[model samples]
Target: MLKMMTYFQGFSGHQSVPVTVDFPRSPPKLPSTSEAESETSMSEASSEDLVPPLEAGAALYREEEKAAKKKEKKKSKGLASVFSVFTKGKKKKGQPSSAEPEGAAGSRQGLDGPLPTVEELKAALERGRLEAARPLLALERELAAAAAGGASAEELVRRQSKVEALYELLRDQVLGVLRRPLEAAPERLRQALAVVAEQEREDRQAAAAAGPGTSALATTRPRRWLQLWRCGVAEAAEERMGGRPAEGAEVPESVFLHMGRTMKEDLEAVVERLKPLFPAEFGVVAAYAESYHQHFAAHVAATAQFELCERDTYMLLVWVQNLYPNDILNSPKLAGELQGVGLGSLLPPKQIRLLEATFLSNEAANVKELMTRALELEAQRWAQDMPPQRLDGHCHSELAIDIIQIISQAQVKAESITLDLGSQIRQVLLVELLAFLRSYQHDFNEFLERGKKLRSYRANVIANINNCLSFRTSMEQNWQVPQDTLSLLLGPLAELKSHGFSTLLQSLCEDLKPLFKRFSHTRWAVPMETLEKIIATVGVRLPEFSELQDCFREELVEAVHLHLVKEYIIQLSKRRLVLKTAEQQQQLAGHILANADAIQHFCTEHGSHATWLQPALPTLAEIIRLQDPSAIKIEVATYATSYPDFSKGHLSAILAIKGNLSNSDVKSIRSILDVSTGVQEPSRPLFSLIKVG
Candidate 1:
């Protein structure tokens, strides 16, 4: 029959100095980085080496036990001395034990239980005697000698000899709790390392002071040993605690709290212990520190003990970077892990806003200087333009681009200070950029106000509005920072548009109002050529006003058309006194036809762009065409029938768009039309609407 084989995992005992390898027996090759390979090579030939593998020591102890058992079988009287302490499970003061806790048998090895208490096994581990289980192991083997005994005794022996989840859980669960105590609770693993690390620390002190003529290398040997011990401890302590915790196991709320006070203190203790071993071989220290983040940080997160927030993730990355600043690139695993912790994840915009704001709070003076520079650059350009008081599109356009480029989206020094700055450090520059945007909005607005007059209203205002919107669009694309972060800087440009839209329109109205009124109401009755002048001035101003057109909407542009045309029709209708002589009336007839055609062309062209202006079209068309009294009744009847609800007052107002229409003409036209005015009062139509009595 084949035997079931159990192979012990390889373990190397202590060496006061690092081991070197020579592959002369095999093919010549570059030396391996493996500690085990070097340790094995050193043990094979080095006569000065003292330590042995744990399994070897346990095997040697088993041989001694077998001899004792043989001696006990020859003289049965010695059984009391052997079995007395074993069965009694006596514990010395402060001496570690392997006794099981009461009712904790379920936690013992396999289905059956160990003879000693499990709590005692934990106590031995806490004391850092890596070989603490030897006594219990010996007793279990001695009691379970099945070759010399029967099936019942063998069953009893197997129950007592079985290994439990103790060592696996010690590495997986208990050790992790010590490292991240904020999100974990058990303290045994930390206490265990503290005991072992303290012993290693004392061993170094004695080794260093042993000889006066010790070489520098010899004196540092124990320190190097301590450093390696730290690596080993961190490795064992941070064994993967992945998957779900056993049912009913607690997973802490790490998201709600930002601080890791207990864990931080443990980290500091680790750093202090590892710090002394360095001036010699500090990469070991750095390797161990980064392992804290790589292994433990993930363990806690995977367990739902703590979430890796952006700030915490950034800090951990930086802390690990500092651990190996001079050689971080060489440690690719650490660098890769640091970069992956949260590097590529997109943060929510609101969180980014908070982060950016926090980052920029300290750079107030620099931010102000950038804003000043942007405004001064614009102010200088404005001075060189044709209309000095006129708003220059180029200047404001450059201003928006310059302000966003120089201040709100400055190139942050991310690479140079990788160790000094954390991930949240990105937020610092971002916040300042956003602050610059907010503070200088008023500055942009004031610059806008300074050049209120539009020299070429169509080309310049659109250029200005397009430039502002374009600047924002370009910043969003070109800025090296996150798109979400850069978008916050665009808020101020919208403010400029909101308030600046009204300002630009008001200035245009002030310039053109008198011209519009003269053309509409002049009693001298200007010629067809004069109507061209009105078409050129007001023609250029209406419809595609660049500022409004850039943010164009049907309802809004149509409303502008209505407002301009409403004034035109009302004032033009009031100019009835111009005609008296037959020669003058004939001359006025030509002028009125031209004015009506020009007005009709105006409404038709603009109404095309803003389709809502279409309903007002016919009203302006009829108003401008009304020249003779015979045509008046027909035009009035057409309007009343088109809008059957239009009242006599409304009919009179509609008839008043012609300057020649008088009270007698309007009264006779309405009477002929018989506008019922049944119930609906006269309300002006939207597109061709004119403010009238």
Candidate 2:
């Protein structure tokens, strides 16, 4: 069959091939068929004769299978190419299999042709076999290099720069793998550098924008570092020294220094630029300026130190003083410091005097001289027109002056000191007292005469009266009198006479009689009739006595003998005349009881003598003997007529007598002459008859 097929394949190539073929015996049975049918049969037989055609089909199938095998071989070769690229360390230059392959082909046909899982990519990166990642890495490197090289540079420069960039990126990645993780590192240094650079840039821009004169470079820059330093110092100082100091120690110096350096220029500029913004702070500055001079005086060679410490210290002081002026004033340490400096020595005499006066006024001696000195200093400071020093000087001077003025006006009267002095001194005091009283009255009257327009006139009058009374009381307590001189001096005053000086004198005597009695230890020796006669003689003529009758009747009478019934009829009549009302009579009775001796003496004087005594009877005889018959007769007649209820003529006759009498004598007479005609007659009938009607 092979030989035949071979020959047929050769013959076919040389000759024409049949269009149809059929089976002989089986096909002869179909001769009766029509020509079209025969043609159809021939067509069918041609379709059925497929042996050679099948062989042809088999050959085509084999060709298709061979073509598929060759395609698969090519695909395997492409896959091997990609796998080699991925697995190789570097591409071999001239090796066909190791040559650069198309990206899509490599990607599609490689062992890792499909999308890589995260683990695979990570493993690939970990292994440092980045041939698979080279293209991506190279692209990134190029971008970074371009960025680093800047757009203004050429391509070659960019490429050359890319090498360093790639190296740096790889180095970082390698280091990240080898060292501790980047998550552990701090980012602060980078951030800080960035901030610093940014600030520097801003500063430069600001400087460039500024005009020549306005430029911060020429002015502010020179002080910028200093300013920053000062600000830092100030903040630290404030933190340390913001509060009040401890008991004895002062504020820390750093605080003041910081404030001094930082705030001084700013403060001055603020004062110039915006004075109204900080009134209190400005005031503090002024106060500090003033206090600086005060504090400067204490330490030795203070001027040099002052120059050093002045500005800051002044600022601090001014701030404190303005806030608390009184507190500053009261600071004893500050005061002592000021005084030590002889600040007061610089003041004018007048100002010093004023200060001294004030100290004297307040009774503070220790500070008086200091005050005076301060005043002097103030004057000097003023004269110098040194405002910084003047305030303290003026304050001290004014304070001293005020103190002195107050003290000078507080003097007490000399009479208040009378008790400390002797009677001789008292007598002088009394004279002074009298003079003062008189002057006071004169002044008061003058004040009134001056139109009574003065507000203090009445007050002066009252004060004078009080002073006079006080003087009198003082004199009475201190005055020493001889026993013999007592009666002689007081006799006339004891008499209750008329409304004149005698009355006043008599009141004084009466008031003083008991004091005398206590000293004498005896009854008064002077006859009551004599006292009466004296009072009657002196009363009308004494100015006080007359004035007393008009202005002070009751006090005037009380001032004289408190009891007048024991004396002569004139005394009784005067007492009755002065004390005419029922109330006055009752008060007089009470007074008599209070002063029994005086009352007895007065009664006995009036009861023993008649009111109408003989004109020839010497006043001395009547006073001594209590024998004024006419005075007695008049008293007896009046008593009988006045007391009709008492029918005892003897008692009535005794009562009528105008000389001092005792209460016992009157009682005895009343008992003996009770209603009986025999006892009704006077005991001294002869004397009574001598003045009978």
Candidate 3:
């Protein structure tokens, strides 16, 4: 009964089961001995009659199971058919189905080719086929994963070989684009950058996706293309430097100029062209700037270490200090281009210091050399008996202009680099300039002493004096000339000026000496012919004064006026001729008055601003002419008031000329002249210059 119930339960549930069953061959003819036994048999037979046939039940269960399976199969087939139509409709024209063989599909896909050689990859990259190249890169990564996942030795090598080939090709392509960004197509550059970005993305994904000890993470390369790109830019910069100057060529400014120009041109392209193509995080402009600056700095460092000439050193300093920062990196064209880029020095601080030191040392030597050469050239001109060329009727030489330019140019260049450097250079130049000034002084003195009779003597003297003045002016303006340094420099200049002025004045003095010798108390009463001759002599030289510089001319005129007055006083004092009679004193006074008038007229007409000296002779004439004792005392007081430089010696000489005065009268007039007054001395003292003895 348990077995029958289990069989019936298995058939009655949703589960499919065969209905065939083996029944007992017949109902057991059990004990009919009692009426109860007969009734139990009839009841069992009635249960048997009520049960279904096993064949029919088994067939009905089979039919239902088959129907459900068939219904499910038909529904799945319909769904599959609808999905196929949708997928096929969305497929690209002529694209192979996934069911196609690998070889057949690959050929149609254009992915079938010999593994790309380096040259082939380059060609494709040139064509901007970065998208096409991605599968190959992916394959290399897959190979790397396979090798990392315990591949056989042979299989590993084979996979690695292909992987290495791909890597080399990719590296070359990336570096090439960076090295020649301007030459690469804009789209190609963008694509290359995209590929690099994609590689970074893949690396990140792989690192994140794999466990710490997983094969995928172990197989992933770092994708250091960004770093390689910087190196490539550095190479580009080095290439742009055009190599060290040729063996015999002067390391000219053009070397640095070319470097700066190319850097700017390429960098501008990166900012305007490549920057837009790349993402902001790539920092395209800054990367190029930093790379160029670093490589340029290294190159400069190497160049500075060499034994360069003065010009080469100067050119290098100009580029590194001025043009690189002021004109190239921070130029208007790239004004906003490198905003966030930290472009470090073109040379390291220590390196720049060394370079600056070299520059100052070299510049000092150069200044000395050039200045000496300038003096030598001037000396040569002097030796040739050539007068300095006159510009606008004034003597001029190249000495001052040349020296000033040399010093100024050095200062400007150094200062542009750094003020401290400029200050240092100024000190160096000052020392050299001082030495040159000394040499100039010696040379000029020799010329004045030896070249006195030469026709060019006056002109050359004036030219040198002008040179000294120019040197002083330029040094004061351009350099931080200290007081002592200025004194040292000015000492030579002042002496040169004095020597020149004396030399010039001596000529006029020579002409006037004979005229002055004629003056005496006896001759003073004669016709004023001597005075006329003196005036004429001075008149002849007045036009020649126009050849001097304006300031020097005025000073020379004042000097000439002062000297004439002093000579007049000296000549007058030397003659102790007494004016005993009123007529003799009056006549002498008239002659003295006429001479004063002539001298004053001549000096004033010729740019002499010495109005102070004008009163000296006239007042002295007034003192000499007055005969009344009391009136003569008044005139002496007037003379003392106007010519405060008049001393006791001068007074005694004048008193001696008044022969009519009694000894008491002379003592009284002398008493009236007081020397104790603390009067200010004249700026240009004529009487002090005159020796009564």
> Which is the leading candidate under TM-score?
3
Candidate 3 residue 276 C-alpha distance from true site, Å: 0.2
lDDT by residue for model 1 (181-279), tens? 222212333333433343344345446546544121112123233344445444433442222234654424232111122222233433444334333
Question: Which stretches in model 2 have alpha-carbon errors above 4 Å?
Answer: 1-408, 411-554, 561-693
- Candidate 3, which segments miss by more than 4 Å at Cα? 1-192, 202-225, 228-258, 380-427, 452-494, 504-508, 521-523, 527-529, 540-557, 575-591, 622-644, 658-682
Q: lDDT by residue for model 3 over 107-181, one digit each (tens)?
A: 442332334433333333333334334445536655655656777765554444444444444555554454555
Model 1: CA > 4 A from native? 1-373, 380-396, 403-463, 471-527, 536-567, 573-608, 614-617, 620-693
For candidate 2, lDDT tens digit of each residue in 1-693? 001001012111233332111101110111111233223433332333111111112234345545545443544343334335444334445332212332322232223233332222222233232232433233433443454455443443333333223222222232221111111112211221222222233345446645533210112111122123223323323332233334544433433333322222222322342223322312323333233323322211222234333233323332232212222222332343223333232223453344333322332332243334543453343334332212311111232233233222221111111222122233332333333333333433443345233443322222222223333333344345455543433332222122222322544556534433331232223344344454553344334322221223334443233223223322322211222243433443433333444433442343323222221122212222233344533443344433332244423342433234455545554553244333254532222322211
**TM per model?**
0.36, 0.19, 0.66
For candidate 2, the 10 contiguous residues with the lowest summed lDDT are 1-10
State, as a TM-score between 0 and 1, how close model 2 is to the true structure: 0.19
lDDT of 2 at 508: 52
Q: TM-score rank, highest first?
A: 3, 1, 2
